[model samples]
Target chain A: MSTEHPEEGRVVRFPTGGVSGEVDIGQLFDAHAAYLVRVCIRLTGSRAAAEDIVQEVFVTAHRRRGDLIPDSNLRTWLYRVAVNLVRHHHRSSGRFNRFVDRYKVDPREAPAGPDVDVERVERAHLVRDCVAELSEKQREVFVLYELEGISGQEISEVLGIKLNTVWSRLRLARKAFRVEWQRRHGEGDHP
Target chain B: MSGPRRLMDDPDFRWETDCDLGDEAILHEGLELGALKERVLAAIEAPPVPPEPTSTASTLGASGAAVKGALGVGLAVVAALGVGYMLGAAQPLSSEGVAEPEAVIEQVVSVPDARLPVAAPRVPAVSAPEAHSTEVVEPVASPQPLHRAPAAVEGGASEPVRPAAAAEVAAVVMPVQSEAPGTAEAPVGESGTVVAEVAAPGGVDAVDGSRLDVEMEVYDTAVQAMASGDYAGAVPAFRSYLRQFPGGHLSTEAELSLLECLFEAGSFAEAEAQASRLLQAPGFGGRERELSLVRAESLILLDRCSEALAIVDALGERDSRTAAVRRECKRRR
Candidate 1:
């Protein structure tokens, strides 16, 4: 059985036992699935692919359940798994930008609703394209920090980089992203 | 979450916090998180599909059950651990705060030992290109110029890119491994497509390493042929892949690509037969949509509008490609 945490439903705890007597995956999914999905969507540039990759992350976690010792930062662990998978997805698909173009839901065909503004959706796509232009190091750090709201120390943990390196890469990523954003949106604007 | 570290002041980069359309909010909207969770759980609980035998595709009698039982045991052990983690021993780390003692992350999670080779890592399989339509248009240029004051804002999206190739009846599809350590190859394909580079994944046992090398070589040959628009050349190479690695992890993908080659080469009847045969094969559950669509298109090309319509209708009416196929079939009828 699972119940959401009292505050904001951010954490979900499970009462059942696992094979290795480690953390319950149901609880993990309830807690981190949304965050991982959002990060993956930015990483892969496709909702369907992001969903698929996140599912694989859980499955991989399950397969390696023995690794889930006490005090293991499962969130960071899961993010690591996700980063590897996203890298594989990008490497396997080749020219990930093209893959994004192929899989990106057309704003014109975006789900119809009162809240779904085509211009906003298009701008979002533009933003994703800019992020994709960053070097892989910068992109991962930038997405984790700026988009996902993960702190620098945690981003360092997830990426296995020094805290200083994380900030340094982020600084570079922001600069590169702005340059690319300018190129796409035209010279006068700074994103 | 820990308070963010010291900020650099740049007013132009405040996309993360700018209106309701900040980076996080835009990315977060439209995702069905609950439904996605349900799907993840369902997939986790589902039975593992047994691989087809090397000797023959149809002989799943006793051996299949043995394989299934082994896989079941493996999964059962993991599930028990998962439950154990939940019920008693290892409580999941609470998402209470972002800043944890550095020791916890370091002591617990070492990078996983198994990894792909860093130089020229090959994905074990390739998906059928026909699964996605190539009907892409150029990105609309950004409208008004926003100012660039350097205060903190939000994140953005991927890099802008033009569609890699024009729409074609038989678009060539292939994976490009990042350059190996010694190669001096150009990054662009002959057709002007940009091939992005990536680091490699190394470290495997000798036998597995050699086997993967051969597999990648064979797969690469077929992909190269396909990329060069030599469907005739690609067809035989793909067939060779099936013959060489019957029960290989990527066998189904090879089979699918083979069918697509035939379809692209205008051999509609042959492709349709292959598609139907694979569609009925065991352990191909998730691929029904792609296989059926390709099969339906082949039937339509063969002037069998009724049969095509039946397949298309079975796929529901929501998918744009399926809908397009239905419209085309009905018009032809």
Candidate 2:
């Protein structure tokens, strides 16, 4: 079973047989809950929605815990669950939430960095807006690879798509992100 | 042979390089995992109730009246069957012992788009006469609904019965349905031209009611503005339409119109991106040729002729528009 952090610095250690081992739900939450929350936050662009989705993800995992196999990758499984929940949220809520949430970064919750400035926040907003511009499929791959730093192979597993398909979507996502970035920030900026 | 680019393989191309900040710092914005673990575990122990169904209908033009009690019962019955079939046919989600991973992946990835609202029920049970019921079902029955006769009627009576005219027709018929429902039911001439003259607008009203009409109005206003050469106004109008009626049948028209506005306004790069995004969307069909041409033209203007030619070659259409685009791409190359 693969044990990797979807976000940086947070490390997870899964038993060899995936979540089927002696590890309980709390252990799984301890390891991957933060990372999943982070991914969901970006996927949803809303903390409350992300929290709701991730909570549902764990609940689903609990419901289907019996389905877990020793050889199955728990991280990929969890990611799939989170992505599915996020997609469901998108459908039920429609595009308005995402559009409104694009600029809804809470001023009370600024960046973690000590030197956070207005320009940095603006750039972050621009990047998030550009990322949000991607199609659902592209956004899935883009968020996993670019923002979450997940490997292509692991992303393929998580998304249940072929590696080639993952790469193709990533390419399109990157191109779309770059174009959106240019459109929002400036016409000629490569970012 | 080279494969697609990976971020790890090329440091220069990463998003972090774009803005000198870590992705986690920007995205997470200092949101921590502490205290949330207990909330997650607690929630897992006591699963929360699912949220109440929102008023949002998955299919475009399906009115609140349609979903309230009118079409909801029939749609729910059909949707139940569809869900049953989907569940039975879906591969077991367990990663192990799966014979066809690709099939499983396709099923999982395609789940959201194939929800309850899009259950394809061709039930011809509209309030209209028997002759016109088929017109209502004909558009909604297809997985990709197109505005056909309604669009033509909206543009002008003289306009030909083509799928392209449906956008305008949807616009015109919408207000009629809202203001005066009886006028929509009035008899008009010709069977084949029913959707254009009488049945199409009436059909939409009878089946979907004001919800579909409102959507059509939004889309039509944008298309009208765009047609009148107000590209700037049209762009926002189309964007609003898309935001309101995303993934609806009318969305295809809205997206295409948005692309047109962007391209006409000399925003070729943005147009290309929008075209690419739309082209990749699920259920994106019926307008592939048109969208492809727009993308190719946008790429050509952006000086990406090789990509444009590749698209042109794939289309394999020798029409004048394609021919002109091809010549322009070759000259630029």
Off by over 4 Å in 1: A1-26, A93-105, A108-122, A189-191, B1-12, B15-21, B48-333
Proportion of native contacts present in model 2? 0.19
Candidate 1: lDDT of B157?
9
The 0-to-1 C-alpha lDDT of every candidate, in the order given, reads 0.49, 0.52
Candidate 1 per-residue lDDT over residues A7-84, each given as its tens digit? 322222222333223334566687678888888988876676677668767765554443345545667777876775
Per-residue lDDT of candidate 2, residues A1-191 (tens digit): 43333432222233434333445666677777888988887887767667766766665566545555555677777787778657655643332232223424544345656676767677777677777788889999988987787888898888878999998898898888877766777754544
For candidate 1, lDDT tens digit of each residue in B215-299?
A: 3445445545554555566666666555443433235445655775676566779888977887777644434655677777778
The residue-level lDDT of candidate 1 at A29 comes to 83
Taking the tens digit of each residue's C-alpha lDDT, what string does model 2 give over B45-140?
453333212212222224223332333443333332222111111211222211233333343345433422322212211122223211232223
DockQ class, candidate 1: incorrect
